[model samples]
Target chain A: MMDRMAVTTTTRVAELHELLARHETSPAAGNVPVHPELVELFPRGLRTGAVYSLHGSMSAALALLAGPSAAGSWCAVVGVPDLGIEAAADWGVWLDRIALIPRVPAGEWTSVVAALVEVSALVVAAPPEHISPGEVSRLLARLRTSGSTLVVLGNWPRAVATLTGQVTRWDGLYDGHGHLRGGSLRLEVTERQRTRYADLELPVRP
Target chain B: MISAAPIRVLLLWCPGWPVLAARLVQGIAADRALALTDRGVVVACSPAAQAEGVAVGLRVRQAQHRCPDLVVLPHDVAAETRAFEPVLRAIEEKIPDVHVVRPGLAAVKARGAGRFYGSEEAAAHALLTHLQRFTADELRLPVDLRMAVADGLFTAEHAAYSSSARQPLVVVPTGRSRDFLAGLPVSVACDRRLANLLQRMGIRTLGDLAKLPRAQVNSRFGAPGLRAHQLASGEDSPILRPRVVPPELGLHVAFDPPAAQIEQIVLRCEPAAEGFVQLLTRSALICTEIRVTVQLEPDALFERLWRHPWQFGKTEVLDRIRWQLEDLATEAVTTDDETLGASVLSVQVLPESVDNAEHHAQGLWGDRPDEKVEHALTTLQHRLGHESVLTSTVAGGRLLHERRVLRPWGDALPTLRERRLEQPWPGTVPGPSPATVFSSASQVQVLSADGAPITVDERGTVNERPTWLRTHEGQRRIEQWAGPWPIRQRWWRKVKQLNRFQLVDNHLTAWLLLSDGAVWFTEARYD
Candidate 1:
């Protein structure tokens, strides 16, 4: 009876260890992959059917997109003409799989965004200036039904989460001689009126 | 005894067909001097060009020098084949079993046609008359058509080449091809190396090569030489594989009263589109390229060629038609051509190229996981335009804006040349590249400590240290900055000289600044 109890206990312990490892590694249901350096802010990874409003850092937004894009999911950018492809590539986003919708007339902006939401696994759009609440709701409903994520470049009302990062100190620059190599960023994440802070490095990888 | 008989072939040859096709299709005047060049060498020249001493084997520059009015055109193989299709159709009316040797050359089994028309000469005459009438009626060209009947295709082709314009039909008597080919040079076998070798061996003519022992010749030169020797001896073997003519699968839809709206035409043509795809599927084929011709009322015809990366489906076909119709509508509005209020009378969809269905067949597990994504993107494209939905790739360029190449959905992705990308561009801004690259750089004022505008001198030295950056947004203090890397490019043509700088302001935003020796501009932003 003692031997049997010991075997059972060891087996139970192994099972519990495996479950813990999987919980830590695997993305939760309705969540997509996020960069390892960004996991502190997005603990459950980027949630599906949710809007993430990103401000102050386009590189951070591209970094967020790089995760799912590198994982071979189709991502799109709408109305952000200046979104640098080279930067997106440097941030680890697969340049070929990403679609860019640079310009859309104000009248057809929401419709175009909704159409992209239906197709892409994730869409990054800069919401136009004159978008109404109704249009936003309609787009959110489409996003919910399609189970795709949206990352807005600027302000988005009632977003599920908001990310703001500021460059604290740039590395490899001494005012004149050397180039701007990388930098440090003070990243802040706010969800449900609760805020979390993380200190990260730009270009998480060398 | 029957094995000793050589197969009879009737060959149709059109000299200078490339120039003739260019004239017929491109509407180049026949009286004008025209030469078709392939790889900088004149392959064919029209008679008018020949009158000015231009000929095949002449360099393009030499030909142009000889004939100052020479119109040089690159040889277009596809256009040549397209122009030859109607001629093949016209000949197929007389002989069903015709084999195309190339665009300008074709052959048919002379025995059947000869027996049907009572004699080889009668059959040749009959074909010549029919072709004459067909060319005059349809192409409206005085096509120099030559026909010859002889034992085997090689002898028949040589006979056709030898025939003059006056006597366009040359019929070599049966069993006499040996004598007919004896005087011809050994180069007629179309093997340049072997001909040269044979000439070096003092065998200059086909009769000289034929005089050698067959077994010795085979032992000397192997398979190709043996084949050439057989051609020289006029023992031509039967080897023509006649083309199995494909059935016409082009779809044609006609509106009785002419459809006004683009949507209405697309709606009415939905059944035809389905039928076209289904017909291709039934034949185990898929069309990759299609030529769409839209005929509008009041005698206006608009045609366009569309290509698909994959096989065209019904939905894709309908989308292409709708897009083309929308383009037509817009063009009508802009050009104010009589087509402004004209209705679409008919639309024809013809497959320009096709592939076997097995190449595109789905696997058991299914192919293309992004079919739904493609469908949705195509829907958006229809709502907006083809250029609105784009996929991008990083191309090799020093300029940030030039590095990104965007293509529409379903368009071929630009291939990245690794060697070019691996180039050491001296003055490009070092990565990590800025995230947002402005298409047009906005002007900025980089001010020194005393607020005077900073500048770079001709000796590549900064006039002052920049402390504040002023822009349309607002003025901000430059917390960190980098040097002005000079870029001098294209000095020979249009000189582009600029100095680039990287600056980080107090707001934690990074800016890529450029100056053309005078004013500063923000080229990109790391926002």
Candidate 2:
């Protein structure tokens, strides 16, 4: 009976360590605030020093930028030549504090982004056509040291979370009739190997 | 405050100095009809131009019509100041404490010079002789100079202006300045509106203005009028504070055999940059702007003024030099000038503006947090060209592309001419703004349900409803569609009539498409 109890106790200790490990590695406990609507997905807000990959939607990426930007944090957008500033402003971004670098040459992409990560609270960029893993790690090191979050428009390897969104339903448009007023966005959020789903409206109302 | 006995001042005046400076710097003949214009209005004119009725305050076209052969040049203040520097230096050799009133005028106290020379009149003549010799012998451009010595700066300046070419020096006897200035017009007080008001009040001459009771003048005309009254009555005790000559802070770096690469020049300038900052620190000042003058071998000279948001450090100075060299290198490829491709011989770094260190002191708490971000942006600007890093403002326009205005970081945003965001730009795409706006529109094929090309008419009617959108990726069936919102702009100049459409495809993503009657283009995406 003592041997069986010891075995059970050992399993209990192992389970507790596993829980502690997950908590320690997860960035969900970070302090940077997200939008109130996004609180369900990010319980503790956006994690500083964490890389978040976005897929199939630029508006979703802009929605992420709008939160910290409205909260008076400086944000930078690099390599997104056609980023809509009006849409960002519509989503409640403070345009005055945002830096928009439309293009960084392929060769200077890593260094430029690394330098930018040192100062801004959040950096949004489209990953260049080709980037080495070594350069990515160097940039990630800077992000960790500076406590700045990196939001990638395209896929980024080793991102802490990946956000994929699609326009599931669009409102206020018909066959040769009304204009595009608002729409519904279906979001698939994956963090720490777990996936969750969310549905929200475009141009999130104040 | 007016003292009982106003100190004596000697004034030197040069009329039409802008025209003379143009002649000296631009090689324009001063004897010909010449006028200097600022913003299309004549600011100054030469004797020949004045004889042709081309005077100050005349528009450029009017002056040109009056003279017919008038040589009009844009007034450049820097060139005027640069050409006047040697003349000021020449006078400084004779008068130890000369105060420059303007580029063309200077003032000095007459008491010390009078004591050194026999009399105030002799001191004035000695100063004039010294300037004439310097201009005639050294500069080779002899100027028509005038001098006056009187009880106060206002009367001394007026006396110098009133002196003729024949009698270039005018001296008012002590305590007789009021009598000397009595015959001059009230406009000599240098207040145009006040002079116009006084003229309407029948105070045409300085003597008429001086005859008014002082208390009455104070009560009726206010402070400026009372000061004008004091000037007319010779009670203007103007303070003549001598200007300290600026120390030599400019650095010259010469690369022997010339620098072939920008990095080489930047490397060589490291020590010079350190020394430049040290020089400013020693003077208890900081440089905020610098003029980098680069000289290329065989004769191409280029200079650009670089302004820093904060005081320039050694690294910033070096970065500016590197950026300038890189800019010159790029210009060489586009321009046909072979001299620009030649090696760079030397560079001159001159401080354009310097401020006291006390004004730039750090706060008691710490530096503002925006500085780190600002510095980072500046670093990015150095790596990329100045126009690469930008801050955007949502300006007013019908199209998505035209609505957002991008300004280079650290540059002053141009005033929104008429495109203010508050204006109700009618017929714009309604509702939520698109997320991705193409910098330049990309062509797309829009077809009807019957697989025929779609077009819009001038009357804002679509020939057929667009049911399919064909991009480079593939064709997508339209789920819903709207808009033939006609955008007509600049109809009198280049008439642009465009019909816009909003289409939601099978994937549920919306696209903002524009049709210029025949061709269709995707302007933005709601994704």
In candidate 2, position B367 carries an lDDT of 26
- My TM-score estimates for the predictions, one after another, are 0.70, 0.74
lDDT of 1 by residue, B1-527 (tens): 11346789988999888889999888998899999999999999998999999989999999999999999999999999889999999999999878888898889999999999999999999999999999899998888999999988889989999999999999999989888999999998748998899999999988888889989998999888788788887888776668756767988999998887877788888999999998776666778888889999899899998877667888888878877887887767645432336788999999989976555544111324245667888778777789898888777776777777777876656545642677777777875778888876688899999999898887778888889999998999987788788877642124367788888888878888888777888788876
What are the Cα lDDT values of the candidates?
A: 0.82, 0.83
Worst 10 residues of 2 chain B by lDDT: B361-370
Query: True-contact fraction for model 1?
Result: 0.65
Question: Between which residue pairs do clashes occur in model 2?
Answer: none
Interface RMSD of each: 13.6, 16.4
> lDDT per residue, candidate 1, A74-165, as tens digits?
78899988888888888789876788889999889888888887766788888888889999899889888876799998899969988897
Assess candidate 2 and give its TM-score to the true structure. 0.74
The interface RMSD for candidate 2 is 16.4
Q: How much is A57 displaced in model 2, in angstroms? A: 4.5
User: Which has the greatest lDDT?
Assistant: 2
For each candidate, the DockQ is 0.27, 0.29
- Cα error, residue B161 of model 1, in Å, equals 4.5
